[model samples]
Target: MTEVRVGDLAQGFLFRRQAVQLRTELSARGQELSTGRAADLTDRLSGDTARLAALDREVALAATLRRNQAQAANRSAAMQAALGRVQSATEPLATTLRSAAAGGLAGELAAAGSAARGAFEDTVGALNQSTAGRSLFAGAATTGPALAGADAMLDTLRAEIGAETEAAGVAQIVEDWFAPGGGFDSSGYLGADSPASPVPLGGGDQAALDIRADAPALRQVLAASALATLAADAALNLPEDTVRALFDTAAEGLGSAGPQLIGLRADLGAEEARIERAGARIEASAGGARRARASLIEVDGYEAATRMEALSQKLESLYAVTARLSRLTLLETIR
Candidate 1:
């Protein structure tokens, strides 16, 4: 046999390199065994990664859609709660005003005006609600509140009233102020001119949360409050009959608004259901994509386990050999 001598340094280096490779293979095989998926898809699938890439995109897209659904659900729920508050605040004011206007005294009617102011503030507060630091009713302009503060909004109305105490004039001013292209849109309401865009909830469905502070139902309630608020202004010093008539107007206006407010909440409830249904479909979509990806990358569990066991044994043997070699001194190796 031809003489062959390997230097101790070169032999040790090669053993170390082999041990490192065996450990790496052991780790990879262990992962495959546990996950039933190949650690190296490129090597396992003969370098074809197009299908895997597509599956990855599918999974990512599903995840994104789920996030969208969650956000839409949250926003709609917030809006629903706020709308409920508005309705709650509105119904009581109507009752209070009607009671005062029907058979009550001037003091009772004035008290009703105070109550209207409170309800107006409550409605404004409800509409200006924010979720996750973004305005719920601000349409596309979510950075700020949906409407100006109650006092500021009322101040705008006060300017429009401008000393008018006649029931018709006050009603007209309130109507025009909250009308389309009016002071409500231009000053009192601070949301975007356009409504918020619909949120995609997958399966070709969208969660359309377009309710804003400038909505007609909301305007009606606000106008009712504004009318009563003006009628009771001590500064105007109007007669009891005029104030009573204005209170009746405010009460009647708010009474008719109940159905519309209820309808708005019903609409949001429908969106909530739609989002939930879309959620189920989204989960199915992600599950389907995951299964497809798994089919491409999965290995036989038995085979994977066997490979892992073999790698583990090889690594142990290499470690034992390396440890034994380390015990051999340079003089011993040379000898």
Candidate 2:
């Protein structure tokens, strides 16, 4: 082979280029060692980024679903607690009405009526409860109270009953007002007619998150309590037997209302259970996505450390070569 010679400038350029390349490699290796992940995901993907992108998207979606599920679960729990308070308030009133129906004296009947009024107020307070500033029973109208204030609702009931002289008439008016799509829609409940959309938890699963003041069970309880309020007022004008009949009817209505409230509670409990299960599934799915993404981009610590050591050696060698080349000037070579 013929002897080949490199000029000083060419040698210097070559040394500089090698030094730059080595330094770049060292830097990349250092980053991988520090972060335990590849410096470049695109390079790791090796011209097939579609799978990595899909997994990353899945992870993002799963994170969003986790937040949604958490919010739904919290709201559902608040609703369940509110329902418990409502039930507790109504049960005592129910018991008192039962006593009144069992031929209680006027004073006892009046006392029961007072208890009913208190229960009605307590129930209203429960219905209007909020979680994180969002109304619990306002359906889609989450910013405002679900029901009108207790005084307003009771006044509306009284107006609806007007001068009805008998218990039957009072009961009919109460049903007309309190039943679905009735006067209560316009007067008592301030919540939206439509319920909120179901909460989406990943993997195509969703959980219901709907509660409203005018739900059938709630209406039943509210209507029964309103009738008790009316009976208390009518007690002064109506005959003792008529008043007794009124209390008897109110007692029976409250008895039926209890089961209705229980049914609503059961429904809410089921919803809570479903949300919890969905949350667990979402967490598992999110973890799988994270692991898949990590596999795509994360480097093996031991392998990266080994590569870093090798790069360090190469960089040291490159620096020495560059330094020796700098020292070997044309004059030195000529000497």
Candidate 3:
């Protein structure tokens, strides 16, 4: 039989109970410390890290898209400006041709020819216009001029006047050069199309720059004028009545081309507006994403500090109780 002293029994029981209580309090303190630390550091960091990473990726994507849009916008703007210049140049030439035809002045006819040549040269220059050192009208071949030595070609046409055979040859050259599948086909302002090449300056299922080197309206007017000039100066011998008829036909053709230019310019304006709105939306979305990511990741320092202080106090109290229990003796209990 194990003999137990009453004093030892009381002291042992108290020590066991004290140890149990201390362990319970310590466990509770440990759990509170772990929870507070996790909330302050791990939990917030984990959530924020993922959210911030995702936001960063989104920001990068938006930036890339914005860059592409900016390039497109710059190209579109350059093309529109070129088209505006061409339209302005063509108007006076068309008006002069009309006036020359109305009045049977040989001088006026000559002046019309000179004006046409100038306008054609300007149009060729516009087609070769560039943006950021890249040829705007070169289609996929943006390294060089869309049409090589285009100025020489216009000069050749200008000098080809005053002979029926020569004018016919020049017209054929122009037609073949700007034909639907010719070398200069991709050099035009618009992309390839079967029936007719559309303008390049509009959005929504059409190109964003509607200027075309081979537009039917423009071609018809130019061809009519060139043929008329040839007829008046060559086989027809500048007969007053023949000159009048040729001039009238040329004038009518020029009028037809004018409306198309106006329409194309309007289309360019609308596309620029659309691009602006899209860019704005992308910027706005990026800002919202950044805010959301920040919310996920950032910890509240004040809250974390408060929780740590409370945990420290509880740990101190547990330590004091544990020390007191460890120092207890059987003699003290009996007394």
Top TM-score hit: 2
Pairs that collide, model 3: 48-297, 199-210, 200-209, 200-210, 201-208, 201-209, 201-210, 202-208
The TM-scores, one per candidate, come to 0.84, 0.87, 0.59
Better of 2 and 3 by lDDT: 2
Query: Rank order by lDDT, top first?
Result: 1, 2, 3
Clashes of each: 0, 0, 8
Each model's lDDT: 0.87, 0.84, 0.58
Candidate 3 wrongly placed segments (more than 4 Å): 1-44, 148-151, 155-212, 215-246, 296-335
Ten residues in sequence with the least summed lDDT for candidate 3: 194-203
Candidate 1 segments whose C-alpha is farther than 4 A from its true place = 1-24, 31-36, 298-303, 314-335
Candidates ranked by TM-score = 2, 1, 3
Which whole-number lDDT from 0 to 100 does residue 99 have in model 2? Answer: 80
TM-score of decoy 3: 0.59
Positional deviation of residue 133's Cα in model 3 after best superposition, in angstroms: 2.1
Instruction: Write down the worst ten-residue block by lDDT for model 2.
Output: 234-243
